[model samples]
Target: MSSSSQGEVVYTPQREARSAFPMAAILLVLGVGVLLPMALARGLTTNSELKVVALELCLLGTLAVLLQPFWGLVLVVGLLYVRPEESIAALAGMRFTLLVSLVALASVLAHLFLSREKLVRTPFNVMLLGFAATAILSTVPNWNMAEAVLEISKLVILVLLVLNLVRTPQRYRAFVTTLLVFTAYLALYSIYLYFTGGAMQQGELARSQATGIFSDPNDLAATVAAGLALALVRARNARGLMRLVYLLLAGSQVWAVVLTYSRSGLLSLLLVICGFLICSMRRKAISTVLAVGLGILLFVVAPSRMTDFDRSEASANQRFWLWSDGLQQLYGRPLTGIGYGQFPEINGGWTAHNSFVLCFTELGLPGYFFWMGCLYYCFKRRVPKATPEEESEEEKRDLVGARLALSGFLFSGFWLSRTYVPVLYLLMCLPVAAQIAARGRPGPQQVKGAEWLRDCGRIGLISLGSILLIQLMTDFLK
Candidate 1:
């Protein structure tokens, strides 16, 4: 298949011959035919029946993935974000996430090999691989090698799946829409939890929490902040009813973040809003007015604790101490620090509570460069410029939304140790995915030799500056 200059894929005869099969339908029929009688049988125990149902579902899901890998990508994403195991006791013992992700990875490999499709390359690929390598290398003497390996594997699979599956504009939109829907659900559910007194209490504050990775109120707020940014961008680019839907989602996410009462969450939300306004090309006056109004609403509705930055605040003081300890560890081993996943163990059962510090402390300068480089390139637009008529509005919206989401996450990460989170990898990959969907291939230019050195230097300087700033803040707080 060849791609047009306009990014429309043109399939050759061989590629056209490889059209989607009816395997999913056949699998569905077979599963129902076999499981229906088993489920109806009165001789089966409850445990046996549940196991049977789970088996049938897994069979169907695996078949679907083998036939259409994009569905598998979506399913894996859903599993990661929604985490049914946490909510459903039955699923807790099933190892469903690991099984589905393995199947998805296999499917992606088979599809790429069979279809002769080139792996879509991005500017961040090298840095990401370097970061993964560093993780593996740093694991040699780490106390938690197994956990570190698992986290690195997940990150790699997440990156590969996004790069390979989201190859078209239609798929990109579908993927993003799926994320927005999931985010809306999580946000609304958190809101529900708050009102129903199901919220979790941190100290004296009752904070809203969602299932899965969002169980932490701060993480929930940060995720919602990213979703809100994307929703705002989509709403700006959308028309009619779809615009209304996105706007409502954005508003709900905003309120949900406030309900979390996370100080970092509030900062992330503000950054997202500011990003939207800055990236926005039209209706500046009206957008500014709406943004101001939103800010006021957030302030009015936000819990008083959300704005508290007292020097004596327990959490804030703990973070400062953690940062200080993390820096000390990095100093002890500048080139190769402790090891990945060793921070909590070495620091009296406390994490760095800062992503940057986590990277420098755990994996050292090399790892820190790779990790920050991935984020650095995320903000850099790699797609070649197109004429106004040739530019896809949807593509533009997707790119803007990806950067805004990353901004929110990164700002929040300054106060959270999320270095290995799948959400971070997903956010980093979205821009590259969008670019590939728009351009139909990797850009011609690759950063190499001198340019690569320059970028490395810049990342190093940034890392140094961040460390110094943290040190200053810690000292001032003391």
Candidate 2:
């Protein structure tokens, strides 16, 4: 099956045959080599039996990935978001995260090579590469070379897989669906933890959190905030049962964010709501009512700690000091700044707690330019107006959801050093992916020399404005 430029579904026998043949071959080989052996095993010890099961599952998963690669991408996303290994003791030693990521990367590369597919071209591609280059250059004089390399490699692999795999509207929907489902699961699990006395204690309050990447309540809150935006947008675009499911997911996400008691998270959530109210024309009255109700509920449920913005608040003060340190570091090394992963080492075991600050301070002005340029283009680019018939309303909603997700993440990043997180990179990839998918192929070069220069100038202005805002806030606190 295939889709036309007008979004009509069509059956293509040759394409189906081409796709099915490889999948059938893979299944046959897997059954013969792995599944049959597992089935024939007799009198195996319990541990050995578990090992066999793991191996069988891994082989099956690999086969599926080789056939469609999107499943592999979803698996990697599941690892990053749900992180079952951290909660499931039996799986702790499996290193499934690394295993699955490597498999996905390899499968994606193989598929692209065999299909003679070019990497999807976008302006963000060059900016991402430029950022990676700056990271390498920054590491040249740093002692944390290994850490820098590992982080940069992850970023590169993630970007490549997203750019290459998410080439169709179907794949884009799958990606969004995967994120929403996992986020809902995580939110529900966190809520259960909160009521079960398993929540993590921060000061006098017990805050809900998840395992692995979301272990920090602030991080979890940021994630839920983004998920909330996605759920709302999805619900708007969906029908009947699926719409109900998305609405429930959105509600759970909002509750989960509140449970974290993160000021940044709450602020991010508010921003998402406001963004909807401003951007959504069809349901303005309904959205306004919902927003007001949510605001009231937030005021009632919010912890005093979250509501407090006094300069004497320990966490708030610490963030101000960290911002100051970041600015000082940037000033001290205006050209090269500190190296990647060195912020904690030089700042007494505290991260910058701000993505922009971390990027500017760690990789200096060049890295900042690349990073900001990437973000700027993410919001700047749009689906071509000529393809309006091809770009369905559902696709447009997905684009808006992606933008909202990024906005939520970015707003939360103001109080958390999530510059290197996979979620950030993934959110950055979605808009570009959507634009590419809408065009039905890689679009023409987006940025010219003049456009590049103009972007740089705009980024510079944003940097200056942000610096001024930070300085004023720090001074006011002082």
Candidate 3:
């Protein structure tokens, strides 16, 4: 054959290979995709269970590789072809924390284009902008631009996930229960630690900390406090043994929180409890107040078990100094507010631990308001505004999830609170947004399922992108 003729003739083997392997490849891809989230979601039972689960997933994932190996190959291509510069949204894994943020930003831009006005008016958005600003400016001075970008991205992914997964009550309940169960386990572990672990009686402010499953006692206490608060909200809708289990979980967590000797956690727990009581049925409010008063009196009338308040004298001062430094930076760069996470770039002055302060320093007044405003909007008087006949199932679920999510958002005071755990946060909040989205929109059975799938695709891309990002920025996280 002539050279031109030979070149024009397609390779039969390559064509056949593509045709033969498509389904297998798709299958393999699906298997790995499913396995990743499942492993991430239910991968850990206990420390021991974690290993077993990993092995199980590995075996299963391998089977998928054998059966639908092409799918895996396809996924790899999709990942590379889709690349970060192509879209702010990444492909794979359904997660909402990051998606919501991108959407909100788009919404703001859209509003400006259509109505010629600013979309976000709240102060907290300014704070977020500040954080972003700080992170960016820090990038120029420090060679850790990659790390800072990844950190902010992780938090953004978290917010996106919260918006997506929390669309239904069932999912919302599952997420809440998951947190409670994990917290209960930690609470039990903390009890074990209290008995078996060593105590520090004289290391000054940081001495009397409770170390649970985690290395840091403050982290453990903070986690326990958040769990207890979340459990209190969850138990209200439960029944019989379910309620009992949740109450026990809450109690254990409360006990764990007390043992941590973290005054920040104590204050957070107190605020959550007070909020819980206020949200309770009016008739029960009086009794709850009286019981809570007695419980406090018993605990803190004098030197009690939860008296770690006297400690951490330097912690607040340190944070104050950090805030002061951050403020100086913010004063200079008010519009952009330094850069996203630039604080550590200049010197180790510690962070403006308070989210409120961090916002002012990093992104400035505008970004700060937008972030806080979202919270304010959610926490606004959730009066039963809907007529009995008007509210749809999705709407009801969204409202409920929103209330619970608001609780979680507010509980971020004990430590640095951003959307680090994207999946967890999205699972917690998606039900509310979904429920709201569903009220005005309804469909047939097959269609709704398809909608769910599409929703997954949307969130998955963002989440998958986030996971990839996390893997990419291991150095920063470490």
What TM-score quantifies how close candidate 2 is to the native fold?
Answer: 0.88
Q: By the lDDT metric, which is better: model 1 or model 2?
A: 1
lDDT of residue 340 for candidate 1: 87
Q: Which stretches of candidate 3 lie above 4 Å from their native place? A: 1-143, 198-214, 284-288, 291-295, 298-312, 345-349, 380-385, 388-478
User: Total clashing residue pairs per candidate?
Assistant: 0, 0, 70
Poorest stretch of ten by lDDT in candidate 3: 6-15
User: What's the TM-score of every candidate structure?
Assistant: 0.88, 0.88, 0.58
Query: Which runs in model 1 stand beyond 4 Å of their true positions?
Result: 1-48, 281-297, 382-389, 442-445
Write out the backbone clash pairs for model 1.
none
Highest lDDT against the true fold, candidate: 1
Residue-level lDDT of model 1, residues 113-208, one tens digit each, is 665655655557788999998888887875567877777988888898887788778888888887888888889999999999889987787899
Worst 10 residues of 2 by lDDT: 6-15
- lDDT tens digits, residues 1-478, model 3? 1111100111111112333356546655776678666665554653555354544544454444344332222222222222222223222233222333444334333323443322212222333454455555545644667867766665543443333332334544554555555556667866775766454444542222333224356556655666665677557756899888878877787667766666555665665666566555466768577658955863574234345443245655455556556656766866665655655555475655655556556555444544443344344322333344544543443354445434544454424423233322333333334333333222111213554355335433543343234233322322
Superposition error at 115 for model 2 (Å): 2.3
